[model samples]
Target: MKILDKYILKTFVITFTSVFVILFFIFILQTVWLFISELAGKDLDFILVIKFLMFAMPRIIPLVLPLSVLLASIMSFGDFAENYEFAAMKSAGISLQRTMKFLTFFILILSLGAFIFANNVIPYAEFKFINFRKDIAQMKPAMAIAEGQFSDVGSYNIKVDKKSGENGNFLTGITIHKKSNNFDGSKNVIKAKNGELISNEKSNILKLVLNDGYYYEDIIPKKYEERNKIPFAKSSFKKYIIYIDLSKLNNTNNEDYTISNTNSMLNISELKYTIDSLENNRKKDIISFVDNSYQRTVTQGSLSSNKALNDSIITTKIKNPDLLSNFIPKEQSEILQIANNSIINTNYTIDSTEQELESKTKVINSHWIALYDKFVIAFACILMFFIGAPLGAIIRKGGLGLPIVFAVLIFIIYHFVNTFGKKIAQEDGLTPFLGCWMATFILTPIACLLTYRATNDIGFINMDVVLLPFQKLFKKIFPSQNQ
Candidate 1:
């Protein structure tokens, strides 16, 4: 590298590193703010909390890296412009693009790094973060029950008035509500004087033992049956035990329950696989629905129990009303009944087919959208560098004051567009490719324009100069109007 290139590149690196560190801390604090409520009152271990913070960093890195590129570019170029370095370079025949050569290469390498991180580190981190949360959910037997609140453990809701014992295993004044099963619409309510929690590790069961409790089950009367009195059961017991399956709650050994195919947890290759599979399924389902509907309509509408009736109907374009009117009264009634049956069956089939198609379409859109988002971080970082450097030079200012403000404003626009486009894509409103790259498409031209203006030493915003002519034209058109 030349001496000038080395100097400029070194300055850019120093500013970039500083800005990245500051942004990392800010994002970490934001993470803490978001999840503090869940982590605060749990009396969790310090080491686990640190691990939680570690797993969360990968998710934040994707968001913060783009912003860092933007802010760093703004500061570096803005500082150079403010110090008259560009003028000196212009005198030496070094164009603005020439000055940015080394930094552009550096940003390209960073984009590659961002892609690797998104593919490898992000998927693993997402898996770990979500798995750790599930483990924490089943960490302790007492963790299931909170003081003065109902804890939903499977289908049972257990509420406790107060907790005692060294590990919060003993409770007083407990109420248990067991929700109705599919066979019955009656809920069973239990009021207990005291309770104790016992964990059976061998069987992987959590036994909730209640003492001095009364169970009440209310039965609803059937409309077709006459009852003299309300059918209910009241039972009093000295002790009762409710068994909860710890295997389901822990979910460590079960891949079916623990692992997910959600878009957030898939890498680029997995996303592509999912998209292909979903699209294939959607096509097959559509074909099947069409075949089923056609078969049902033709087969059900035939009265001769043969293909001859269907062939005649299709060949002659025979109307069912006309055919029924020519028959005697009884035969006409039978023909109308057959036609009505066929119409009802066709309507049901169509409704179900529409619902199935809608569901598959949503799944296909999800996979496509996820496939598109895999490139977002890498592309965003590279794009932001192009945008920020030229904008910084145009503004001719540096440091946290104007640089940060401009960075934030541009970042907000980028973020809003991305989020809005993604939301629309999720609902299958636009093609996945277009929805994912909408922000890039909107901002690329502006970046090119800014770069051109900065190279020519033109103002970023000269709206008044252009608007002055229009104002004069309007005045000529209506001289006495508002003014």
Candidate 2:
């Protein structure tokens, strides 16, 4: 590298590294705050928390890199201008473009790094981080137990009174209450006097080894005449095994598997997959609705026939009261009334199913649209840079204060426009891709204009007129703005 090229490259690297480190710290702090909030009552080790953050860094780096590049380039170039380094180079016959050559190469290298991180590392990290969080949440009971507080591990609620012996590995005086309410209005509560949690690593089952406990069931009799309490007392066995449902923990594996199943981390491809899946689901739902509607039509027709039959029977009985008493018993009439009520209930159920299916279809469609929007937002980062860099040069104030303010204002405007477009797209049937890129498209021309004006020294907006009111008045009176 030439001496000047090396000098410029060093400045670029230093500035970019500083910005990246600052932004990475900021990302870490925000992530930690969110994680702390989420894991507030749960028990997680400090090492695991640190690991989670470390895994998250790769994902955050790609997002921070591009912005860091922009900031670094602008700062380095502005410093060169401020220090009269550019004038020195110009005097030596080096053009402005020549001065920027090294910086551009640096940017290209940074861009390539960002592409690798985004495509390869970030996706894997995201998948791992998510799974780690889920595992931590699932194993919270083992990690977050207090001496005298009730802790929920999966479906079972356990309380431990004392912890001692060998680094608190053994939990003494443990009480567990297992409640299952799956059946219609039936509850089973198992109370264990002394239980130790044993996790089988191979099978992933958390076994509650109960020393002495009783199972109590309050059964409502089928006759409806009496309620009975059935109790089973522990006698022979020292330990009773209550298996924790490992299926709940295994459910997250599907999401992990799905993430790992795909090789490419392209946002557009993911969006397309989501759209296709949603469309297929929608089609299935439509078919289900049609089948349900057909069934409901048949049921309604049957119910109408039943109603007519009952009406006919009542009319005939009313005409002959003596026959009603003799031919139809009082119990038979009551049974008929109950049967009619059941038919009415069946009609209500069909109506409810239809409504639920309609609601689900709408939700699925909304999800598909949302995925499409996210795909567009991912690409907008590249578009935003084209606008941000040129605007920075035109503004020409490279201190922390003005650059930050400018970046924030520009970002806010972009975010607001993008959000507005999404809302319109959702409500009306506006194009999803267009809605997402609207802000980028609108600002791109502005960026180009700023770049042209800065390069050519067109002075599109005179700063002196805005800063000094007298200059504006003088220009208006004299009719020669430049003079």
Candidate 3:
């Protein structure tokens, strides 16, 4: 290898490594802030906290690696240009493309490595991180009552408006859902104006003392016909005490804990399988719903009866426009009541089916987005390198000053577009493939333009290209006498 190639590779690698570490640390701090509630005041051991962060750190690589490439490329190349090293290389017959040969190959390897990490490492990390969080939440029964949001602890989902006092045992505006065998929904709901958590470390139970509370229990009817009545029991109490068993929760094994089914936890093959299964299930559901709706709304017997009635009416040549007038009052009323009930039931079914289908579709879209995201990470690294390397040469400014400004502005646009696309795709406004690649598609031309300008030794903006046509038009319109 030539001395020049060695020097260039060494400089770029050093800058890339430094930038990667700094950006990774910054993003890890952000991750800690995001999950602080799961850690803070939970009395978790230092080793557990470190494990939590370690499991979460892999997810940050996709975000950090590309940005590092962009900033590092710009800084390293811009420093060369600013120091007139590029001019010396050019005088010695080294072209910009020639200088980029080794670096391009390096970037290709980096991109491949990124793809491998995203496909394998990120999925594993996500699985561990999410399950670890679940285990941590139930590590202590008291940790389950996180303020402002629902926290699943054992069979009860607990939430509190505020928590105060040492150890945050004093709770305000508490709500709890006791999920028993009823997978249909939460059957028992407890709401309180205030509550207190009383626990003994030696015992396997936690005592919840409630003040000014209401208990609501929904009644399930044994008779199928009476199910629609929506019966329930509600009672208010000045003070209520409930015991929550902490034996299973305090056990850290989590053997009975249900694993989370988020898209982030699945690799490419798993995602494909899941997405296919979900789609097939959705199809089967739609077909079943349609058949059920048809049977409920219009049966074969009803259709035959309606046809007979229509034929009879046509043959009788009834002059009256009001069909109900022919029936007795009792029959008419009965028929109207039955019709109203069928309409109400059909409407309900339609609404519920629509919501279920929409939810399933969104879930499928999320899986597709996750699938495309792995490849996007690989492409983003290459895209950013091309943009940053050429941009540096064109601008000819080094250090953290101008390079930082350009990098931030460009990266902000990329991040914003990427986020917007994913949001739209999640809502089914756009296809997942397009949504995932939109930012790359939008910024690719900028990279090409920068590369071309830098290769030809043109400045940042080519004035000749911008003004040539305008100059010609001006001369033609003015009709210069000299011409």
lDDT by candidate, in order shown:
0.83, 0.61, 0.87
Write one digit per residue (lDDT tens) for candidate 3, span 229-293: 88899999999988888775564554444576689978899999999999999999999998998
TM-score, one value per model: 0.87, 0.66, 0.75
lDDT of 1 by residue, 1-483 (tens): 999999999998999999999999999999989987557645567877888888789988877999999999999999999999988999999999999999999999999999989888887788877776666546678777777877777778989998889888898999999977657566789999999999865667888999999999887778636444658889999999998887767654354555565777788888888888888888998898889878877667665444554454456644466665544576556557878888887888789888878788777877777667768889999899999999999999988899999999999999899888887887778877888899999999988899898888887988989899999899999989947
Candidate 3 or 2, higher TM-score: 3
Instruction: Please list the Cα RMSD from the true structure of every candidate, rounded to 1 decimal place.
Output: 4.4, 8.5, 7.3
Q: Write the per-residue lDDT of candidate 2 for residues 1-483, one digit (tens) a residue.
A: 799889878876787788779988997888888777445644556776777787778766644654565565556666666577766887898865676677666555555556545655665676777666656655533553456777666676767777544334356676656656566455545555565656654565666576766665556566654544532334344567777765455444454343343222334456467667766876787788678767865654334344645554545544555543533565456545655776786678668877866665555445444445444434444454445445555555565666676666666676688778766654544565566567767877876776676556454497776778986677788886565
For candidate 1, list the clashing residue pairs, or say none: none
Better of 1 and 2 by TM-score: 1
Give candidate 3 regions above 4 Å deviation: 140-243, 246-257, 300-345, 467-483
Kindly report which residue stretches of model 2 are placed more than 4 angstroms away from their true locations once superposed. 1-6, 37-47, 61-63, 87-116, 137-141, 144-150, 159-162, 167-169, 172-179, 182-195, 210-241, 247-274, 287-384, 415-430, 458-460, 463-483
TM match of model 2 to true structure: 0.66
Q: Tell me model 2's lDDT, rounded to 2 decimals.
A: 0.61
Rank by TM-score, highest first: 1, 3, 2
Error of 2 at 416 (Å): 5.0
- Candidate 3 lands at a TM-score of 0.75
* Clash count (model 1, backbone only): 0
Better of 1 and 3 by TM-score: 1
